[model samples]
Target chain A: MLDQAFEALKTYDWGTDVAVLAPIDEAVVATSGDSASREQLERRLAAVLAEDVSRDAKDYVCRKLMAIGTAASVPALAALLPSAELSHMARFALERIPAPEAGQALREALASVAGSQKVGVVTSLAGRGENESVAALARLVGDGDPAVARAAVIGLGRIRTPEAARALESAKPADPQAKLEAIDARLACAEALLAAGKKAEALAVYKPLAGPQQPKHVRLGATRGMLAASGKKAD
Target chain B: MGGQHQPTRRRFLQTAGAAAAAPYVITSAALGQGAIPPASERIVMGGIGIGNQGQWDQEAFLGRPDVQYVALCDVRQSVREKYKAKVDERYQNRDCQTYNDYRELLAREDIDAVHVATPDHWHAIQVVEACRQGKDVYCQKPETRTLREGPLLIEAARRFARVVSGGSQRVLEDYTELVNKCWSGELGPIKWINVNVGPLSQLCNLPAEETPADIDWDLWLGPAPWAPYNALRCSGSFATTGGSWRSYVDYSGGGMTDWGAHHFGGATFAVDVREKQPVEIEYIADPQGDHLAFHYDNGVILYHNRPKTENLAVEGTPGQQREAKPVPVYKGEGGIYGDFIHCVKTRERPFRDIELAVNTIAVSHLGTIAYNLRRSLKWDAAAQTFTGDEEANRYLDRARREPWVL
Candidate 1:
């Protein structure tokens, strides 16, 4: 039944009988009962992505994969990451799939893909909170493409770890615009620390940026963050 | 700190020095983000339903140093012109765009967010679409006119990952103090809650009137059941506080939803209800009486009517309890506008998130049905249905006019 629905997805239009895809839902639910069923469901969807078909079919399959895909499915989805057209849908599945290999696939793509596709892959890794890619992102933080560097900073912000902050604090961008995002990620790291009740750690992230030698704007933000961390209202 | 990507000191100094002279120095960076512009770069915004409350909101957004009103929209051309001229003169730019259709303003990718002060019936659709477009939304109080619309709007925000702050500004510390106090459990099992927002409305029966030229009557009735134009029922005046639409079941649920959005939006934050709906409701339709009451599974009951306190309060078995003093909004930042703007930059949840706002409004819609039937209704909160009451369940959503989709 799930295979029939997968075949039907190739020609499914927006207003098609929504029930025709009920098998896809049943397969997704069926996976939750055990790891074997989950692997089978994920493999079925991953196989669909490797087929020659419309982008819509891949998107439909990715939607199912988001709920059930695993490490076994990452390689098939990863192969599509170099395709500008299919990478987004691939990332959509990869972003929600909880597997270290999925993160590694995204990290490997950083040194390979270029332009917005690379930026988007960086964003996907960021969305996954991939701490292993911090060094790679720190390198991309210096990418010639300002948009990609900016995307890398946003990626670092989502990571919310001491290492991500260390890289963000040190890396300088060619684009003045990207520096603002680097500063933003630094603060995000502080905020996450503060939220976890690590006031001292949060203050460490704020104090240097709040220093008199820092840029006035950065100083102002860091000062506010420092005060807020120390139990004073800055807003 | 870098191999080849370091920006020159001269470039950094130029941008930083330029920012020193911009208006409202460092106002939006409380979250450490918005833009890197010299003090002057503004968050672009659009105002929909610029009549009374909408006009006031338009002015509020314009008043910020960090916000630029690129467009203004209202269903009535007269009101649109009135507010557009005000915005144009204030910005000293005559090119401020005006639109009769909100979808037009929403189409502009330059807009960072929208202030949706449309009528209650139009609130859910506009906010949902705006969020779906990746634009942050500030929707007015009584965020939804029906229960079914609530989940869809919430789903849109969730799927799009956009900020949606309900415009019930009164849920601030002025009201939260009491709810926060009660949630601490010092109130001792809160025997009863008197919300007292005022009365509920039944069917609207205003006499029909000729449609005015400046107003687009059909657009105003979007998604709502068809009704002939009536001056008292469908005018710019209805956008003001205590307007005719508030008394119409088709357009609104009267004061029941109006103050319920304010009181109930903050009630959960105060009380220990956490996040859940009332399991039952009883509605009575006397103009001067307690119009409705909702029963929670926790055995705490809430009543609606005009109350004496300026803020939300509750009754214990022995006495009344509230905060020693209120958490006052800082002088310049005193309303939902500041909170919404802050959330836009920080991506933190606003004071009144619309999903929670809808949860409160759904209770009021339950009240509206109870009043219409004049009977007690048992509700299954999980299923979102009435037990064996088909007629009552039908009131969860209304029939739409042709071509107007939910």
Candidate 2:
């Protein structure tokens, strides 16, 4: 039944009867506890990505990889990261694969891809909170592309490590919009720091932004962050 | 981290003085000649995803004398233009702006609040972003698409000090009788309750069709996995059976979350567990069929589609009396809508506060996972993970398509 499902997947396309793929879904569930069976299934699914199958078929495999893929499936998924049409689904699996190799593959794509695809890779790295990619992302905080720069800024904010906070503090964007994004990201980083019990670091980010020169809302956020960091209440 | 505090309205009223100073014409409309409030006193508002529910929410806000509806946004050109025209007609001006992207509307410093009726997938992103932008939110029900989104949404609201109200009128209005019974001590220490909802959202494989000119297909599929543009695939119908985005796993939890927001919300509220989530979910496979039993830390169990049990059915300790407690209701006038407006004016948490709303939807999501894996599971609500179950944990959240992050 699983073999038939794999055979059917080669022809799967959008609008095809999903029932034809039910056995594969069942196989995923059936192999839950059996790591050997799960690994075999993962290998087979990854191999299909290299075959001449429809995009939908590959998409289906990526979704399955999301559930069972490991470092072994990283190479196949990473190969699709350069294709504009396929990068998203590939990242969809790599983003959740819980393996260091998947994060490394995404980090490598940072240089291999460009435009929105690069933005997607930065986002996946941030989503996984990939601390190793912080320096690479920090370098892009002032990228020529506004979208790429803004995404990098927001990604660092989400990462929320002290190093990520420092990256936002050091960024010098030419664009006014990017400047505002940096402030927002810094505020977000401070909030995360305070929550993670790094009061000194949180206060460092909040102190300067709390000044009158900043926007009213940003000042308000910084003031609140400072008070919380100081173990005081915001009246 | 401290108790939720309600800020006074005096500070807002004081800030309005500057804007009030700029106006000079004392025209009839300026004075709010009829029953309407003057422009300076009105809550400046905008609408996102102006489709079925969005339209309904827009009408409710428009009818208010204190709400100044100013903008409409939707990925669909037709929907936004149509709604923009209606707002312009109602206000007797061409001032109502339209945007295909919600970010532009949210960027407006003038818009004090926004009501979002976007699909389940867009709820968390829009709501959190709206909060960050300093706009109070009146987001539609099933406010979270995944379990991971719940805490983040709650934090955004609290961090920004925004008044976010979840759209679930039925929780209080529809289940009034049962809620009264439970809270009034008429049901005597409720042992368990059953909420019948769902046939979990399935994978979508609907064939690709010609992309319509009226819709921004890419924006419509924002954050969700890419799929071909089929009309039925993106249709805003309430149906959860392959007819609309609601039926697809990428977009929704099908009825499990669509109506589950109402049923599970109503059930949890009735049992006074609106602030809590189930700590354990026991999958029951009986001769009749399969169902789920969710155990709360308070020792109250919520059964999802239990065998032969009617919806919102409760089994309480017979004839034992318990102390009555006050049943919470919407503040101010109108129903849920008015409650939101009132909270926006003052800084009180709305009746359907984001935290409570997220708790309500968490039940639906947890049940969806258990049913998918067909096994009992343990949940640590504080940690927001499945204890000792890596496979189950994978379903906590999915990787959103590019440029959209939580």
Candidate 3:
């Protein structure tokens, strides 16, 4: 039944059926409880990318692979990373693979579609929270897309590595939205900086967030950081 | 950091400097990593249902040097004129036009996003249409008046690439951190979450009163089941405190969706109840009780009809009230609004994005449907429908008046 659904989905009008079948197909694979059907779904998903079809088909296939959540499709999905049309789907699928190899695939694919796909690639990497992508993602924080930049801030915030502070500091700004986002990023950066014993610089980084006229979001977010930093200092 | 792909200092300065000037800065560094601008460079804001909530939106944006308050639309001319004066005072140099219809607002290319605080029934249509127009949205909580509206709103947001966040601000509260901690398994596995939502006194089989001269009765009644105007539902001249907004099922979903969105959306997020809808709802009523309970599939329960705890005293009891203190779900002022501004800049999902609110909405709808149907409801979370009840299924989705598709 799962294989039949997968095949039905391939020929299905990528427009209507793919959208309708996405969650249904995923649920079928999820509830099948049969190992053979799972492999069949995975094979169909990985190979569907190679077919000439609509963008929805690619997305449908990616969602299916994600639903399977297995490592076997990693190689097949990874191979499509160089295809710009399919790479975002591949990255999205790879993110759901839930294995070490999936992270490795994302890392290899990261440089392949460097400029146009940073947000998708970085968000996928962050979703995995793999340590290997930390340096790469931190660098992308300084990259040009606001969405990509914010995703990198989130990646650093999630990773909380010492090196990420310099990256955040170099990119920090007074922009309301960026400042709002950085409220936590600043706190995260402070924690990371403090962990490295750069106390004064950490405090300085959070001080302006305490000022009046600062956006309420920035002030609130920064105040929390200051409290945490101050508590650590008192201790 | 050193490679052929690296942006030059001059290029970095230009992009970074531009971000520096924007409300939500999208740095080259952050951009290179993939952060969609929190909002567009041009903040084309629109309003639907420009009454009190609409008036508040004008005040919210009026003098803010950061935003351009582009347009206002409401069903009533009086309400529109009142806010127009307020806005004109704020931006004396710029002319802000008012419209009696919301569809015309959707037609304006200058409008980039909309602030929807319309009546309960109109939410799904106006929001879905705005998304189709490629406008981002800030919609009030209880994203839908009914259960079926959730999937359509979610689909619309996905289809349009718009950022739709619910106005249920409790998701933005600090208490939310505690809730997230609980969900992350730090506060021990939550065996049961009791959500005490209301005082049920809000719904009254009240006698109808006179409709005011300045109101447009029919447009206000758009898509809702037909009912005559009453001062209680119209001017809300007699509601209890801040919740007079609840008197009309046409304008609001009583206390169920109003406070339900705040408490339920926050609790749903905290309890990891964001993905699925409730399996059953059994509303227990006693002649004297102030709250009701909504039960989910995972053994979690939300008690909405009364208050049980003493430390947290909710100022207003749910029924027929107006001018009450803002409910404290998130432990802060400006609950979801501040969080959204923050999320926009940071590009993280705020406490109540459309996706999260959809499930919150579904849960709210289930409670209302079960109450209206006056029976226990067996809901299928995956298919998002009720089992074995055709009459109940009809209430799940609503029919748009005309020309609206999700």
Candidate 4:
């Protein structure tokens, strides 16, 4: 039944009856306890991604990989990262693969993809909280594209390490909108730092943003962050 | 600071008093015309996702004399126009604005609060963004789509000091009888409770259809994976079966979360464990059937779909009675809606505060993961992770599709 499902998958496209793929779903549930079976299923599903299947078929495989894919499946998913039609789903799996190789695949794609695709890769790296991508994300914080630069800014905010915070502080996005996003991201980084008990680091970020030159809301957030970090409450 | 800032009524009054020597004209509109409260006294509001429940929420807010509904947002052009027309009609003018994007509406400096009734996938993002924008939120349940989203939602609300109310009236009203019985202490020392809610969401492969011009399909599928535009795949119907987004894994947790939000919310509140998440989930597969026993730190267990146990069933020691305590109820005049508006005005926590709401949904999400893995698991609530189970831990959250981050 699994083999039949795989065969059917090669021709699967949007609008097709999804019931033909029920055997794959059953296999996902059935092999939960059987490591050998689960690994075999993962390999088979990964192989389908490299096949001449419709985008829908590969999407199905990626969804399954998201559940059970291992390091061995990372290469196949990574191969699709440069394809705009397939990059999002590929990251969808790679982002949650629990394997370092998956994060590396996304980082490598940073140099290979562009526009919204690159933005997607940046987001996945941030979503995984991959400390390794901090430098690459920092470099993109002032990218020519406002969307990419803004995504990189928010990505660093999510990364939230002291290094990421520093990168955010130094980022100089030429776009007005990106500059605003930088402030929001900086405040977010401070909150994250404060939550992690890095009081001094959090205060360093907050104190600067809380200055009179900042917007009322930005100053408000920074003030609140400073109060919380200093074990005080805002009245 | 870059945009125009609208001072609150209190701030306005303070400034006005300080400038008493200056000549100023107070129009009837500023003092509030006829039946409506003054502009300074009313809560300026906006509605996101004005579909079935969104419309109902809007109507409730419109009915409040203290609320000034000013904006409506929906991805569907038809829905946006229809609701905007309705709001304009209610105000006897064309003052209400409409937007296809929620971000644009959230950018308005004059809007004080928003009620978000978007699909489950958009809930956390919208709520968190609203918090960042300094707007109080009344978000519809289930408050989160994943276990990881629960904490982020709560953190955003707390970090911004925003009043966020969960949109589950059933948690208090529908289960009042059971809640009263438990709080009354008639059945002393409750040991366990059963909440039978089931049939997890499934994968969707609905065939491609012509994308309707009325809706921005990509925005509708925000954060979720790209699927072809099919009416049934995005239907807002109550069904957890194949017809609606509720039935799809990408958009919802099926009935396990859709109705689970209400059922488990009621069950946990009834059992007085509304503030806690189960520390462990034991998946049992007997010859009779498969069920789950969720163990709380306090020795209370929440059973999910245990065979022969009815929904919201509580097992307690009958002979020994415990001390009765006053049941918690909504604070303001109206039900959940009024409670939220009142809290927004008073800076108090609403009845279904975001933290409690997140905890209620956590039960459903944990149970769903347990069933998906088909095994028992230990949850470290503080860490919000599975104990030593990497495979199970991977399910904590999924990678959201491009351009959307929480």
Candidate 5:
């Protein structure tokens, strides 16, 4: 049955781009068909996850497992999350499943890595937009590394859950760059609230930014948003 | 009857005897002829442009019994006579057709496939025209002269569902295993790839020799800008194939496009970077001034001109018996012919897919653009246009002369 899936992908009308990708992806999809049962899925995942394959094959496996989206494979995907060698596709797949167990696994994974990988994971988790994920991102705003903390704060604004906005309000900026980023994060938070259909609250968030001290473009954008929120035109 | 039935189980065996006799079985007429007919269908072969490379190609195809040499075409009578004599002597049959024009040769109903060794400029038109007429093609390397020619050739082949194979076949060896090995991430994520090949420069810098009476200088120039015949450019008598080929801007992309098309095809396949174009390119002339390197979005650096220090060492671990001799970095030989036959049977893409050809042409054109502008440039893959540059687009596709437009 797994072989059939592999064959289908090979013969699939993937156009030229996907056809080039089929061979590696076929193998990963084939592995997923090992068994629908959680026990068998775990066993197959253990064997299929190899750090040594070509980057193409690794990416293929990541996409395939992510597409499966079974809670059963979450443990296996989570296990790989801690490894710095894990591909972004694999990390994103884990984020997509978004089970409480998966979120906890991702938090643990983020705690273990350093540098860009950590930033990537934190950003990915926040992008999931889970309230738990937003809170974690907000906490990262105080991380010792200012770049990471700034990324975390930006990620929180992107997440835009109510919990995230509250965390951002209370968090301290580490430097001038961080201060500028906080303003951007606040703007993002306001926009995300508007997108979420909280028109009154979105206007309230934007009203405070109508000041000369702010970047000219940001101040103008804030005033424009406030007027649009109140159902009036701004020149 | 059912009182005492013993279980019968099928057992598999690998017999050394049968293994040893496998070759003999294939060679045996009775068994072989029963399963597959001997001389079942003749592969009718035609040759166009019987220049030095074209003549050599004829001999290669003629060496096979399956290929029936039906037609030979060239602008020169001497070339026609030379191949006709060789074919007649070998086959002991004088029923072969000869023509001075390739269009006449392509028009024949009997020819199944054509071997096109025409000049760089004529490749696209001849190949596309042949495929449109339902003829499979074996075109010589560089596949096209410019970016504009690649898609036309690819579209023509695909529309006709014809088997059109490039002349460079090295990429298909062991399925480009070594190249794939590099992409497989074993080479520590390729920091650089240096091609020992570069452009075929024009030999017109030398004093012009008189045009030979027998050569069709006009046809030889074909779509290239017309000029009085220089013996050095037309016959290539004074230039080494590499030196002459690399120098010519009109006929070739210096070795960069010619050999780069073949080698870079493998590099892209191995790297799994077939889709994205190189985001940025900067050409560096050597202090002694021998070569150039093309950098890519994926951090892969491809150098052509002179060999670089990084590409000199072998890539992987030594074999069991000895320290690993450097695996050869590139393969250059009868790559075009060997792979064409394989694709014909297997119905699979030859190592250089048409898409790769298109992308490689786009990449190769960068060098020409750089040389002409005498500066580095940024390529925008999304816009399919160079950023902040209108002058560069002019060189991307050259205007075909009268009577030829793609």
Candidate 6:
């Protein structure tokens, strides 16, 4: 039943209705919180993931795995971490997986994936806001590959902790694109700080960028940031 | 979904798999196509004023196989050729045409519609001309640079019976979705709506710079009175914000109307003010720059640039205000580009149709005029004029350049 739902999932887009997934979706929802039912679904989904089913079908099952997944579902999702076609959906499941094993699986693959793949893993870590991954993120902040380095900068912004803020302030990138990205990331850290109620620390981040001495775009952003932060309370 | 797959939009969807993952993508299906359908239902389009926003508008349509950009136009020779080359390269043919003037592009009988990405000053003239030529228009926001021109554009659109859409697609998301909730009284008679984007544009004062050889300075200054060409004014898109031409009163209405049209476009959906206009407009004091406040006959107020939040804020009755939450920002699925393609096929009026655009632009224009004159103004919405205010009335439209008659 779920396999045919995957077949319909492969054919859908924004232009049409997705109601065809209702029957299998009802089955999944009916089995909610039942470990035995979830295990069976995950096993079936894992088999389909390995088959030549369209990436959309795989993405659909991975999202289902996100809701009812156990540590048992990690291997099927973790196998996709290296695949550009499937990694995003894999991270979608991994990010929501409450089990520590899901995170451990991501950390184990962190060292092996390179280029954009590494960037993807780093992004998943940030999305999970895994504080344990901060040191790993700091090291990649200045990676020689600009895409990797830029992704690391954005990742630090997403992690949004004081440690992440400090890492962003200290990391340096040689490439101009990466340098611009670092500047933007530092501001992102400041926003994260504001969101966390570290008002003075956030203002401190803005002051230097606001000075006339910084680049025009940088100064403009900093000035606006200060103006916006003046009296508004963070919710 | 089989054989002799020519290039239709839905057909392109199945084959173009997972090119890039977007936060906005509801399905990978929006990204790819497997069966290219026949060309009989294909929408042929021309892109006018292919500059910054023009290129952004063009980019959305370029990827769709059903909509083909047969002609490109721009005052700048370099910008037009750059787009021409891009269109040619994408189609793998030299059939894509180029023109310096928008009117010449509108003359092509083969084209079904045109997307207007020109500056504010040129919006009404270009949109009207395209409509007069029986071409549907997808025009950029703040529908007119001046108040008086909005009606004229709408008049032309109605007379031609063209499917005219204002380019603010944010209003297209279920008229965008939250409005339905607002109308359902879920927000309990919204007391005040804060349409916060940013402050209005001030007068242009930058020192003029030498015109570049590649730019046709004369053609770029079309319709609007001549001003010295500064490179800053000529440049487009800064760090993802709207382009530089928006800063000048002579060219665009600055930040206020540019984004105001979009945010208010959403706000009006909630307050249900499509046909009626705000009875009064006033500029409230700000230490940095002035912001606008408009009062409706219904006693609901609309504030521009007064809120801290970027999204439209609906403050309901006391208890509701205490419980209010930010709305999901509306972005049309497939965006305005997709909406236009759908409208072209269905022969339906788009949600952000020209008159709706005129009403929102009028609200922004009222705020802008009040800011410029530094005083409150009484409005006669039916008259489309200010009540007993002569100086404010002068701002309705500027005198067109001698040869470029409106």
Candidates' RMSD to native? 14.5, 3.9, 17.3, 2.5, 30.0, 24.8
Q: How much lDDT does candidate 1 score?
A: 0.69
Model 2 clash pairs are A15-B205, A15-B206, A15-B207
lDDT per residue as tens, model 6, B293-333? 78988888888777464457777774453233444332334
lDDT of residue B395 for candidate 5: 47
Q: How high is the lDDT of residue A129 in model 6?
A: 61
Q: Which of 1 and 5 is ahead in lDDT?
A: 1
Give the alpha carbon lDDT tens digit for every residue of A1-235 in model 5.
5544343333332112334444443444344335444345334543455434433344445545554445666666766655545635456466555356666776777667767567657755654556777767777888887766877876676566667777788657846445645655676677667768888877776877666655333465578777767777654
Write one digit per residue (lDDT tens) for candidate 4, span B191-268. Answer: 999988868998888888999999999999999988889999999998998899899999899999989989999999
- Model 4: per-residue Cα lDDT over A95-189, one tens digit each: 89999999998998888898888889998998889889999999997788778888899889778888899999778776544565677678778
Which DockQ-derived CAPRI band holds candidate 5? incorrect
lDDT of 4 at B104: 90
Off by more than 4 A, model 6: A1-235, B1-37, B172-181, B238-243, B285-291, B307-311, B318-333
Per-residue CA lDDT of model 3 for B230-303, tens digit only, reads 55555533242233546554456656566667667667666566766777776665557534456677676655
The lDDT of model 6 is 0.69
For model 6, how does the per-residue alpha-carbon lDDT over A1-235 read when each residue is reduced to its tens digit?
A: 6667756766643222445665655665566446687678767766666776655567567756765666888988899888865676676677667677877888788787776567767766765568887888888877877776677776686566889888888767765435545665677777667767787888888888777655444565566566556764221
Off by over 4 Å in 5: A1-235, B1-40, B172-184, B199-210, B236-246, B269-276, B284-293, B305-338, B380-384
Cα lDDT, model 5, residue B167: 67
Tens-place lDDT per residue, model 5, B69-126, is 7789887778888888888887677967788878777755556679988767788868
The models' CA-based lDDT, in order, is: 0.69, 0.87, 0.59, 0.87, 0.59, 0.69
Report residue B293 deviation for candidate 1 (angstroms): 3.6
- Clash counts for all predictions: 3, 3, 54, 1, 23, 10
lDDT of 2 by residue, B280-363 (tens): 999998888899999999899999998899999998887999789999999978899999999999879999999999999999
Best by DockQ: 4
Query: Residue B197 of candidate 6: its Cα lDDT?
Result: 67
